[model samples]
Target: MRVAHLSLGDFRNYRTAELELRAGANLILGPNGQGKTNLVEAIAYFATLRSHRTSSDTPLIRAGAGAAIARMKLEAAGRDVLLELQINREGANRAQVNRNTVRAREVTRWFSAVAFVPEDLTIVRGEPSGRRRFLDDALVSRHPIAAGVLGDYERVVRQRNSLLKSGRGSARTVEATLGIWDDQLVEFGSQIMLARRELVRDLGDPLSAGYRALVDGDHGPALHLSESVVDTLKERGVSRETRAEGSQSNVELADVSRETLAQEFRDALSAVRLKEIDRGVTLLGPHRDDLLLTLNDLPVKGYASHGESWSFALSMKMALATLLREESPAGDPVIILDDVFAELDSGRRGRLMSAVSEFEQVIVTAAVEADVPREWDWNRVQIRAGEILPAGEQTSGTPEPKSPADTDPAPGESLSTKDSEQ
Candidate 1:
């Protein structure tokens, strides 16, 4: 699916803006700080429900505004779907599909997108949390219902942690309530772990091919899950390894039953119960697991060079995008490259463009026109000082300075409030 149009009001630097997109190779070009990433971030927000750059929604709201409005008209399989979001600064966010209000997570069921940003390199080089997020986001893209499951899992963890902290009650009382929480935790966490295992297994082939396409030679890129439960099982007499260190070291998760996994999960919790009670935290389960990315039998985080890390991260995203394309009846998920071409060498830039060119739609943001490959017929939009400039308007050199008239909203002007007033 592709976004046919995007509308913004008080989002980032845009007070009010409208952008028309096309089926293939749409480019957003302007100098840095001219809102290039913000536009694509708005589009991607519908897919992931969070910003790639920040963890909080407050920053997404334009200063002095109570809420930010983002609306998009999408086209897929000979039909159009309208998706809208109002990101509030104080209250919960709101969502709409085809003008009908629904739960915010429901918006993801209608659209899918794979965004490649500079921060992706962190997935390989950064902490475990980033890698965990990558896995969860991939799961949600593969099955939108997974959003609810993830939400449930997170809530269970929170509630369980609260109970652990309040162990002031009688020991029997605490144990009784804790057992109920444990059951819910295992029920949801097991589903997540199993789904993640399947995702990693399915992504292996595409990830290998994607990496090979981007770089020369076979580096033997591979994925494995370093599961906490599996480790606990090994401590007992399960005889299964979590890492894909070698043929014998890898656990064939396909053959592993959820009943087996649930038992292992319970065992893990029991082993850690005392420590968890002392620390007042829920320490074992999917939240503690990690996706171990490796290249040529070595961990990518510490062993891979800058170039190799980029290739792995890019390949991972491409693998997920390919999986979504093959499975979704909604057509290809919109491929978004947000200022990514600038970071890659010329060869990889061309190769990356060629790799994604076959998709139904691609949206790219770049600060320099020459950074993007020039062969394709690109539908280009220019931005300056939060404004979508007309064709023939040059946006080279530094971003134009914003004047007061450009920054300030007119009297009685607010997208969220005005719509309600109408």
Candidate 2:
């Protein structure tokens, strides 16, 4: 999938902006606070309906505007899709695809992209929440339908937590009502756990290969899908049924079925029912899980050096992009490198560039033109104070900004110069 053109209105610092992109590589150049990251961020948000930089939608909209609108001309599987999104501050966001209104979540099916940003280092060095988010994003990228599954699971958890909180005083009533929420939790949560375990299993080889290629070290990178239900039982010394539960005698996670997971989840809830009511929360589910990343048999967070952590984070994203290329109906995902090259050393920068150069389209943003690798044929666009000016243009701050672009440039006119020596 590729974005042929993008236009933003009342989004972040951009009152109005538009740009036409190419298939190979598009380089967006600007100094700090000029909306370079904001431009790429808007493009990525169209894929995930969320931001990587911040957690709130209020910051996404212009200060005085009631809403923000983003529209894209996407090319996917040889057809053009017109995707429009309206993000309102006081109401639910809305989306339209091919001029037909649809749920905002439904827009994910139209395009896909994998972003490599400096913040991705959190996957290796941060808390379980970050790793879980990494897992969920990869799950959605692999199967768009998984997004709905994730939404259902989150809703069930939230509703179940509300029931647990409000009905705490009456033990009998709480138990009875909790049984219903337990069934739904086990159903949705078990499916999520199964998918996550399978994803970690499949990522093993690719992550190892990518790490080996990126870092000239003997450390072996491995991913372990740590489940709360199993770990809780293990901590309590509760032995699981071996061969009777549709698993091998040892009950390896890879061999467990959804039914096996559901049964275990149910048992776990039964064991911890009273404790959960006391705490006003739901436990023993995929939401409590973590993706354990290790290097040389050690956890990467507290043990690995800074360089090692960066390499691991980069390898994981690269491996994910590679795996999805094999699974995606679209031949290649739109790769966005947002101010990432500046953070990497020269050797690592060259290696990273070589790793992703083969993709059908790559978008890179840099504060200086020289920071980006100069070997490729780059379709360059210069952003000056939230305006998409032609390449090599510069300006000081203007008193009154122009309205967002009414239309993008003609197809071929957006490129300042196309590198000819492929």
Candidate 3:
């Protein structure tokens, strides 16, 4: 997982652009309101297909443009892969891998990326939906096949919710149709829940180690999956582990298998059927789960100071990157730091840089050159209002006059290491 080249058209702020990239630390620097974030956003969008900044795709397309196109040449595991996406406005988007058309969701299988943005702070204090999304993203990255599993599960949940909301027929008629959806939900949802639980289990040790590196004074970070179905099983009775074939007296997240979770999902849905019908929504599944973050036995969201919260969030992202690096077959996933250095103090900034500097590829964006450490030997790209200057050439359309980036390589130009020197 490294990107060798990238080209963009009508994406975010860029009308037409192309740039060659290296496999080490590549920095994109510019002022605020410029397209620095947009540059990295396109890189990451190839991996997850979801924007960290927004929930919709409309903003991704340039204003007044019918569609946007992004193409990339990637090198992973000793081979080169070309990935392309057509981001349309009215109908479904299209995707191509190595020039062959495939389902849009299949685009995620080709690239693996994890991004650390200022918005990542929301994962700590935000709603459970954000946390669940975080889990699913990691799961898909870890096992690309999970994309299909998650897609089917979400479709089942949506269809089930629709039926619950619009049902006005006889009890038997509604119950018969609901059973079909319930079975599909259990089948797909179990795989999602079990995979998420496994990831959280693996994250506990690494997350603790990462936090200690970022912060001082003996603060231990902990991650726990707050699953709705598991809690419900406990409230109904008591036990540590229960087989799926038998009644679920208790749930053990770490040891639970897909078959066992599917059984519990069926039981949980059965117990909540009346309530679900009344509320007109599906409840008691992975969609309702949350990933709990704790520091020294206390939750970080509402109790920890602002610094502690940021530490917890950073550790989570860093820990996920570490896990992927360990498990990836050929190389580590591309790590993107989108305008993140400005938000940190000096010590944390150094710690963050040291941790990621050794990766196969790391892309950083910042408004201030002083914020990034000078020891990095960084390859710099100067971006201003969607115009990119590689390293040694200067160009027009720069937003700020007499800025630090006024003397850098212009667009469509090849750059050298000497060009990046101060």
Best by lDDT: 1
- Per-prediction TM-score: 0.90, 0.89, 0.89
Q: Could you tell me the TM-score of candidate 2?
A: 0.89
lDDT of each: 0.84, 0.79, 0.79
Evaluated at residue 326, the lDDT of candidate 1 is 96
- What does candidate 1 score on TM? 0.90
Residue 197 error, candidate 1, Å: 0.4
Q: 1-422, model 2: which lDDT tens digit per residue? A: 78888877788887777778989989998888999998889998887778888876778988888777787888888988887777777667777777566777788887788999999999898899889988888887777778888888999999998988887755675787778878888888888888887778778777887887777655899888777898776666667774233323212666688887888887777778788888888877888998888898899989999889999999998888888888888678889999988888888877788888888889999998878887888999987766787697665654232322344322122111221110
Candidate 1 lDDT over 1-422, as tens digits, reads: 88988877788887777788899999898889989899999999899888888988988888998888887889988898887788878766777677666778888999999999999999999999999999998998899989889989999999999998888433543687899999999999999998998898899999999998898667999999888887775665554344343332333884568887787789888887777887778988899999899999899989998998999999999999999999999999999999988889998999899999999999999999989999999998988766786546766554442322223333124323322200
Q: How accurate is candidate 1 locally (lDDT)?
A: 0.84
Candidate 2 local accuracy as lDDT?
A: 0.79
Ranking by TM-score: 1, 2, 3
Clashing pairs in 2: 16-404
RMSD of 2: 6.9
For model 3, the superposed segments whose C-alpha errors exceed 4 Å read: 168-173, 238-252, 397-422
